[model samples]
Target: MSWGTLRNSGQERELFKRRSFVAIIAIILLTGVLVGRFYYLQIIEHETYATISDRNRLQVQPVPPTRGLIHDRNGVLLAENRPVFSLTVIPEQVSDMDALIEEIRGIVQVRPEDVESFQRRLGERRRPFEPVPLRYHLSESEMARLAVNRHSLPGVETEARLVRYYPYGRLTAHVLGYVGRINEQDASRIDQVAYAGTHYIGKTGLERVYEEELHGEVGYQNVETNARGRVMRVLEREDPTPGRDLTLSLDIRLQQVAHEALGDRRGAIVAINPETGGLLAQVSTPGFDTNKFVTGIDHENYSELRDSLDKPLFNRATRGQYPPGSTIKPMMALAGLASDTVTQSDVVHDPGYYKLPNSSQVFRNWKRGGHGDTTLYDAIVLSSDTYFYKMAYEMGGAEMADYLEHFGFGSVTSLDVSDERAGILPGPQWKRRVHGEPWYPGDSVNMGIGQGYFLSTPMQLAATTSVIANRGARRPPRHLRYIDGDIPARHLLPDVVRPPVEMGEKSDWEYVINAMEDVVHGSNGTARGISPGLNYRMAGKTGTSQVFSLEGEEYDEDEVAERMRDHALFVAFAPADDPEIVVSVLVENGGSGSATAAPVARQVMDAWINGFPEVLTNQAIPGAMENNGPSGRDPQ
Candidate 1:
């Protein structure tokens, strides 16, 4: 071959080799790029894809803790938790909720109220997937019937929850209060995260005051779910902490006795341990069933309670304010003795009426013939209004008002219940501000006898009686006893002391106490009717507050309508020498403090001193009723 031909052939072979090398390099680079992309997607971004996959399958749910129980001082269960089966529906899960509910109705008894409640909750602003309650507190028969057909019903579920119970029923209704369904108003104020799965909350009394401690914490769980949001298994969970337990100061036995003693009378009874200031019983007649509020009460039932003349919803013990009448005589006499304005032996002539130094209006005594001449002790024991009227005038309005305020009059007691009324304490400034009128001498006379514009609550009377029993060691009354369990610590009680009214030298506190005892034990004593079978002595003062007047006429119970009669009041501390309990009883339009109020007080004291009969027998509390015996009739 020629030299040129050899060179061309070698160049062609080299060119072909260079093209093969370049192609091989391109193939290797493309393989490397593909491998890198696959590695990034499968290994580096694995969690991102997994999370996206889970988004289509997992469910989260809340678990509510059981509410704690409540007991009285004597270890009797007062408030308890009862298991309840409820039916619910998740709107998002139901293909047609209305149709499903209608279908379920044919199998079970469903009321309009149930339908209305379900619809109302359905309309609320909430997540569509969350379950809404349909029926609560299901009956055993109903649960059994529903169970048989549960498999056929789609999106319908049965859940077991604890329902609050007041075992004492209406007896302790006002004090323990009741729980109700969480409404929009309550939802607005509650912590959404903490109360995520809860439905009920305390509405009033101790229940409302201790809601945080009573309601346990909520817990959450994350679960692996299917495409339909059905739970397969829990991936993680946080356990819920239970609510705290409470020990109350109430004595269930004493509460029952007080409730029974009141009968049908429209008034209140407050009994307390004099030493510790613990409330033994607080009875407010006409209290409604606390169970009605739990699990949501119907409109008709609720309306009946709200519109009833007896005011079943009203709490008369802590809320009723009334003119104290002759119940103030003993306290006033004590004030006179402590202030050195009057001595124990000090005598005042009674001419049946009191004339405020320069006034024409005569304040007459209840007895038309007047109590001849009465000493401070006799005046208190007899509850002679004329004597107090004179003493009040002599002491001046400002002094009397100041001293009475020291006794806890015209002030809210420390019962821990919210909405306590601070009654009127008539003074020159108060009169000017409230009634826009100047103080009058006649006002002082009336105030001294626990009438006129002076007003006080039954709780206030109990507090004052406690002070008297303790001989001036005033501890504000309390309705609850603190017990640490799963509950948050209760709010600390504020330091309180009744003003230091000197009880030493000139104070005739002893004389007044002695006289009060005599009223129940001595001859011709006003309250002797109820004292026949007493084991211990009790010092008390009786009172009659006029509900109506005739400007210049005496009251005749026979002619007056039953509703317009005078209110009977009595306040006492038992075992006078070493007082253990202080009691205050008031009967509306019952006439005669001795005949009406004293006997009720006697029954209460007996229950506290001996044994509570009804409690021992495990008898159910009778309805609010009154004794119609001759003793309870309008007095002659």
Candidate 2:
């Protein structure tokens, strides 16, 4: 230590000075580089970073308008909106979406679909703080549980919004239809931008047909969101346009009466106002509660409705295809008169069966011993198979079909409902196209009896009956009575117009109508049983369409399985001369039109005509249809 201190004192002083100078220079250069980098970041890229920051707070959202209300003619709400709560989540507020959803599941019922839908929406969202729906239609109890746990969850909120509600759910299901969640098929067909805020779309019936009017224009707004992704305020908004209110021609009371009249049977009843061409009631039973469809029907409940033998999902009033049976005879008789194939005075011998010129095959009548030698009036009143068979053979299928088309057969009517069936009105051309066979004389004979290839829906039958009620004048079988408030909704279809059935003889309208009246009023008429208690004149036809051919065997009602039995049908109009209402009834597998179907029609008709008995007290009317037994009898 003593040697080192004496030898290196000067050398050490110079070396230390040199090292200190080098260190000071190095420190100065490093500080200059740091200052330059800081200036570049803080000043040059300031606006770019500011835009990115703002994007995380601001979002554009759709402002959905209120859905339109639907009402019957009497202002009874058929479809209306009611407040419902849905659980929504702000994505930015939750540290982890999955963890929060899992936590919320413990508080309220969280379906797997809700989670799946939320995940999909989260990825699609452009804004950082917008709320996404997690669960829809929260029950009161579920809402209470979620409220109790609100303190634990930061981003979850219960949002109140109006949802579609059907008060008379099962009563109006078929005609009014119901709204449902938008699905893939719906998304493909609808305008995506317009539907951005909406979840439901019309699925069937008038709701589908008038979708554009019912789904109003979509509006937009810019929103400011907080760091938690909660909407702090709406920055700017364009007002949303609400859908137009629609008014229907349906009478709620008549709808209830007809629905009750069907009563556990698999059937349909369609009633129309002949003067206004508006549907009073359209019923298909057994009906399901329409409210179930508004949000989303569970798979199990939908399965029960779809697989049920009763087929409540099937809109039988407009979609059921059956042999028109004797229900079509009035139209046929009019066709024969116009074509001169048969006349009112013409007579035919009914020996219980009809046979073609050289054919051994026999077409048996519903009556084993038919009315021997019947006129056109008696033919319709007694429902003679031989009389119509003779007329069909002479007029031929093509000519008969041409006339029937004028009465709205071989096509769907203008019922303002979607998916209505246009029942088959077959002829030689149709048979050749469909079955690859030419028409036969037997085919014409079957057609005469409203069987074979001939088919008609209850909707079509109601319109046809109304044509007779109007004395050959025509009108659409429509349900919409008004749009908004006073707009008329009839006399035209999308691309079709039904012309009046002009007769070669003007008096022929009365001629066929008289025969129809005899069916209900005549002593030996097929539907005479309903005549006794009638306060006002009624014209009706009873029909029994064979589900399977008799093939020369006598029909034993007791021997047949209930479903294998014939379809009982009836078509009627009340206060015959000044006709107001036209009703068509079809009882699937019901035994006799007179017994099973006519009574149902009578109850429906009486509901309209004999409504407010206190005011109609001067007029003696049967207070209830129970006064009349299941009435009418026919086939052949």
Candidate 3:
């Protein structure tokens, strides 16, 4: 610059102009690039950025559907729904689940079981932002306290929802069962998407059997939530469909009478419609409140019930298996007639006991001096053990099994409920399979009296009696009568196609029924005590099953404990000409069927006939029931 700076102002001006032009061109290029970038970002990618921003404040919430309702045949609501407040929280919004739960515990009452149940659900597989219930069945004060501190607690919500309720909890506990909250084990068994917002599912009885119809479809809603995950408002909503309601064949009046009949006794009663096979009444005494199971039952109450000696949770009608005792006498009579093992003219002179072909063991009768020269009709009327003992042995185990199978023994009847025990029907094969022993002649002799390994449930007895009333036609016992929209196929199926009991002579049905009629109508019948007020003809059989062995000694009720005594049982059907209702009763540790179970059955049948006059013109007979049975139980 020093060499060329000798008086060159004109050249220096030209250089300055060139430098300014270069700087202006560079500025223009930089401005073009900045504009292009702004256009791409604001116009081309507009929807993408907007969606990303909305994701912070928008959410899709699940709407759980309402559960179904259950009703008796008379339209009496058995199971329903009640509105309640529950506290729920989203783990994604919650910074610390444990800390938030602790804060909730401080604000309101939080039971240890609730916390424990919540923890179990938290570990289950779940989607993001899905609210988990912290506490259910919250009180008004608890909800108010939670609301006061809700602002500080993000991701927490107080939701109002409907929960299951049972109107007659104790009366229908075993029949309808209950629902409980979804837990980890339940989550594993269910479809998470289908049960998104639903927290309850059926656990037992008809509830479990009809779960698909009882739980409806879930819906969804697009909602705008705040920074704390509190829902501001719903933008788009889809309504959830409610579950289908159920109408059962059970009669509430009959159920009440049966329950009352079993008052304070740990027993069961099952009544059936002989024509339609509808379960008119199913009662199990010492029942617990089913509502307690709807929500989480407290640990203390649950433990108390679980440890109780009476087994209130047990369904005696469907599950309690006891020997049929003399209740099977009429059925055995039918078997004898059908198998040609014995004829109506055949007679056996009983000397109070019978001995097997070569065995020395003497099987005695209930009467020390048995009915002399007993015919088939007299055997059923007098409940002569010696005659049945001879018949059972002659019929043989194979023939017995085949005939009894047609009567719904050795298998679960087509009852809709899932929990049912297939009462034991013992034979040579069954004995070998279960006891690892061969069937003996003594076994057959004992079975003649409905003892020794021949076990049956009160439900089975009721169904079998229905078969008898139908005169060899079989109708499988069922509970469902109607549904909200479409009824299940099982309700009116299978039974219709099943073949009627093929008999040597169908008129024998009338013959056996008449013999049973004399048991209640004849002067010297075993159940004549309940026959005084019979407006219409009735047929019945009385039975007593030994709880323990007597070892050839006389049974003294005074020496036996109440629980260790014999179980009294009865099977009967009204209007022997055209039976409408068939009832089977079991009295735990009751002294005699004639004294205990017969009276109970009379009350139930009277209630059915008197309550529904259209069914029959029946009036309640004053002093129709009597307890003047002998001091000794029906040891037969």
lDDT of 2 by residue, 46-81 (tens): 788777877888878888877888887756678888
Q: Candidate 1 vs candidate 3: which has greater lDDT?
A: 3
Per-residue CA lDDT of candidate 3, range 466-584, in tens?
88898888787888877882464454343452444665477788888998889889998888998887777889999999898888679999998999999999999987898878999
Alpha-carbon deviation at 2 in model 1, angstroms: 55
Model 1: CA > 4 A from native: 1-46, 125-128, 139-154, 485-491, 494-499, 503-507, 614-636
Task: Find the 10 residues in a row with the least total lDDT in model 3.
Answer: 627-636
Q: What digit string (tens of lDDT, one per residue) describes model 1 on residues 1-636?
A: 778765777788999999999999999999999999989988999899878887767667787877877877645677888988988787887898879999889877779998997898887766447778888877888888888997778777777888998888788889988888787888889998888888789999888887888898999888887756667899989988888888777777678778889998788999988777778889999788898888888889999989998788888788888888888887888888777778877898887888776567788888887888999888877777788888888888888888888788888877587767887879888899888999888888888898889888888888887877777778888876666532322355543566447754423567778898998998867898888879889998888888877778778899999889999899999889888789999888888889999999999898776655643435443331232231111110
* Local distance difference test scores for all models: 0.81, 0.83, 0.83
TM for candidate 3 is 0.89
